[model samples]
Target: MGSLIFFTVSASAPMTVLAGGVVTTYAVTGSIGVPLSFPILGVALALFTVGYAAMTRYVENAGAFYAYIALGLSRAWGVAGSAVAIVAYNTIQIGLYGLFGWAFSGFAAAHWQADLPWWACALGVWAIVGLLGLFNVDLSAKVLGFFLIAEIIAVLLFDIGGFGHPAGGSVSTESLAPGSLFTSGVGGVFAFGIAAFVGFESAAVYSGEVKDPRRTVARATYVAVAITSVLYAVSAWALASASGKDGLAAGPADPFGMIGQWFGTGLSTAANVLFLTSVFAALLSFHMVVSRYTFAAGQEGVLPRFTAATWRRTGSPVAGSLLQSLAGVVTFAIFAMLGRDPLLELFTWLSYVAAVGVLVLMIGTSVSVLGYFARRDSVESVWQRIIAPGLAAIALIAITATVVVNADSILGAEKGSVLTYVLPGIVAAAVVIGLLWGYTIKLTRPSVYAGIGEGGARQAAALAGIEDLLAQDERIPA
Candidate 1:
């Protein structure tokens, strides 16, 4: 369970968020207290987890979102949610390659003077991730743990240094001031803050592999979210102070470059190296989560049986893992050919798309939480079942709306441009494909359709014709 939480927290990639994302927040929102959003989002997430944790006690599938949503809503909605999740997670995982490739190649050049194209570096990473995915997740978990510790140490050191030594002549608390957060472009701050939190929900996804799913998954979920929130909030606060006014002004344009200026070249170089490893950690964490989803989808008969095949010795989702790597390679190749800037074109666009997709998925999950408890009563309290999830759904819906209305600002795309629509369109397409596929199964294979998003006993009934028998018996009584 702790290892699973490590993967979940590592997936958030604190180094990347502090170095790149928070800077963007300052640039866009001019809201220095962008740090405050972390706790706010955390609380919202905690509300979400209330019902989510309760649901984990009942559902038993690696397809976390799909299974929960299916049990709560309907099979078709679960399939649709799964399709969107695959796209969202896949895009974000592949998008990180953009940063990793560019950073690694640049690192080699700066140190060893080994000049290489980004694609070459990316292909090397792809091979490594593909191989790791074949082994037990515990091995990769260890790797993440090492990287995660190093990452935490570095960020904390940076924060402590910033707070101890004033940036200019004096450190200012204006960034933490409440009024600062509501400034001009705060919407972008909220948007990116939510994106930074995308990975904290993964503990529930690893339930089957966890030793005591009931208590472990619930405990891990709470711990992961709490850790992530503090990490982001504290780091952002220190960064704003370390930067001073002059530095803050330039953040919108290049936070990475500005950090180098504040810390001198040596620390800057170290940050660059750490940034590459941070991205690598994020990539591996993403692979594990997505493979589990794919494994569940395939096992539930929504996808090919091949994807359900776990590794013989390790029980890892081998087929799904390799497929995710292959998809990443193809995505990298396409972007490299276009001559796009890895940070701007590759990272920004797809990440925004992913963040938006995640927001949509969470809304679905919140609804599922409410429905699950309402339709099927359990011993859980009403606050856990209804109140918390209701608040979460309302909050998530607002964020999604904000993103849609302010797409141009968050993404910096030209007003009414094709790029602006691309992120939202991918999610829509996934839903369309899922709906078509789900309905097709419904028409052609009613028995399999009965269990489209089910698992464990519910799925057994769907597969063994128990539902059909129950229906017949109901009619006979009349």
Candidate 2:
């Protein structure tokens, strides 16, 4: 349970979210109401988990969204969901390299007077992540746990300092007002707020690896959501309290540096160092997630059988890890060679795309939960089966629509830029390809298709079928 929550919350990258995401969101949307979005998003997610956690008791697969959607909806949509998930997870993982490189390079130049290219620093972290992915997953979890704790401590200290020294010698709750989110640029606030919780839903992805899947997954999911929500909301409000909403909108050159003045250079330097670790931890966590998803798809025959290969000694997904490493190398090389702005193009654009992909999956998963329980006659309550998921579906629909409508602001682009269509089109293409591939498999491979979403149940069913066929053949004297 501890490591599960660690891996899940580490995906949110606490230090990075505070230093980069929250600060930029303030500047971009000019909405101090950003603090209000976290709780709102949290409520929707809690409703989502009401059904999601219940569904996990019945299905156990690493490709959680794929399995849930497949079982509840159809095998074809499951494949499609998995395809988009691969794209989303990979983009978020690889995209962090840009931020990692940019932050590390800047820190090196400033602190040590040593110059380094962002790509060079990025590749250094990339190599380390690739190496770690080959080892046991427990090792990766430990690493994430260490970094997550350190970053959270640093963020809490910063928040305390910010509150200790309020802008006008008194605390302000202007940002925490629910009505703040209803104003202009509300979509941008929701978009950025939800993006901060990117890794919370990842708890169920590790269901197959945990000790007690039923309790551990549910508990971890709820705890991760609660931790991130309280931390982000408090930190955002603290920053506003320290800098004031008006000053934050004026856009200080460096929010961290500004807040650092309230304390001293020592804490400021520590925050910068932890910021690098935060990004690396998120990179490793997402790498594990993507690899596991690939592994599950292979086990279920959605992808090539070779992808299911795992190291016997450590239970690490070998082929899947290598695939993710190759993806990271290729993406980094492309951005490096093109001489593009690493922060703006790589991190910002890819993060936005990942956010959109996740929102789409959440919507699908919420509806699939309803579809799943509707077909079952279990002892679960009506809220778990229907009410929660129904309301979740509606909330998610509204949230996703709002985010998509204001994509221009989220991406920091002109209103009619080609990216508004092209970036999202990437996810759209994955969905289409998945649907077509799933249909092809159903037509050509009936045996493999029979176990699409049955998870462990599918293997038992196949073995039983084989025994029955053998018995019938023997009785015929063949």
Name the best candidate (by lDDT).
2
Q: Rate the local accuracy (lDDT) of all candidates.
A: 0.76, 0.80
lDDT of 1 by residue, 1-478 (tens): 7677777788788887876677666765556778888888888888888878778767766446777777788778888888988888888888878877877887788778999888889889888988888884434566767777877877887777667765775767887777877654555677788878887887787777777776687778788899989988888888777787667776453334444566777776777777777877678878887887788788777887788788779979898998898899888888899887666567666777788778888899899988888887688888888998999999888877777666666666666788667777888888889878888877887766776655644344444656566455442221
For model 1, the run of ten residues with the poorest summed lDDT: 469-478
lDDT, candidate 2, 1-478, per-residue tens:
9877877787788898887678767767677788878888988998888788878777766446888888889888988999989999899888889989988998999899999999999999988998888884434556667777888888898888889988888999988887766765676677767768887877787777878776788788888898889899999888889888678878632645754787778878888888887787778878998998898788778898789788887879998999999998899889999998777678767777787788778888889988888887987799888999899999998987787777777677788698777887888898899999888888998566667776734434333455355335432222
What lDDT does candidate 1 reach at residue 64? 67
Model 1, residue 194: C-alpha shift (Å): 2.4
Please give the TM-score that candidate 2 achieves against the real structure: 0.88
Model 1's alpha-carbon lDDT is 0.76
Off by over 4 Å in 2: 1-7, 136-143, 168-172, 178-180, 205-216, 250-255, 309-315, 456-478
